[model samples]
Target: MNKPEDAPRAFQQAWNGHDMQALGDLFHADATFVNRFGRQVRGVSAIIEMHAPIHSTIYSDSTLENELISVTPIGDDAAVLHSWSRLACGPAHPAGPHVIDTLFQAVLTRRDGAWKIIALANVTLADPRTGRAMLRV
Candidate 1:
């Protein structure tokens, strides 16, 4: 059985690599992805598609640092993870690295003996002057 900690680390690794498929695999089939842009995409296919552009873009370096705030088990099949992430943008986004930071929350579920994310929500925290996110690290 995989611990809840494993899922978050896997998510970070997959995201940094820009591996759309791998990242999608971390989600449940009916997963919901709420981007920082306020756009919500449901299902693994949509999630995969949403990240494809990112992977194709050159100079794109995305890093996610998550501080697990809390974890609650929902019955026996699911868990809710409240976390804050400091997201740093890469060169491809025009803002460059360390220019932006985003906070995120996620809900994960165990399905067929694997832990998958079921829902996610994120928002940007940026510098008012430059309109760029300020990274903590």
Candidate 2:
């Protein structure tokens, strides 16, 4: 069982490795994911289906700059993690991926001694200059 602090590293590693299954493994079976667009995707399976293609395309060369904001303990077997991340493209980006500043919250529960994300919500910060979406979403 990994500590709650392990989630961010796991997430970053999965994204950087471009491994969909590994990424999905971080979530619980009944997990719900809310994207920056406000669409709610329920279940880990649904999240994988939706993200696989996007990750292969616009975000293929993206890397996350993640900062752990806080971890609040809900009980002995549950916790909520708050994090902020900036998704940016590397030199190999196909068409210059949009840079996005995102804030996310994840609710994790200990299942069989392992922590799994049960819910996640991502909010993209608007561009202060343009007052519009910071990323292509």
Which digits, one per residue and each the tens of the lDDT, describe model 2 over residues 71-128?
9999999999988878887655665656778888999999898999999999988877
Best model per TM-score: 2
Give the candidate number with the greatest lDDT. 2
Instruction: Tell me how many residue pairs clash in candidate 2.
Output: 0
Residue by residue across 95-135, what tens digits does model 1's lDDT show?
56544456767777777888778898887876789976566
* All candidates: TM-score: 0.82, 0.87
RMSD (Cα, Å) of candidate 2? 3.3
Q: Candidate 2, after superposition: displacement of residue 94 in Å?
A: 8.3
The residue-level lDDT of candidate 1 at 72 comes to 85
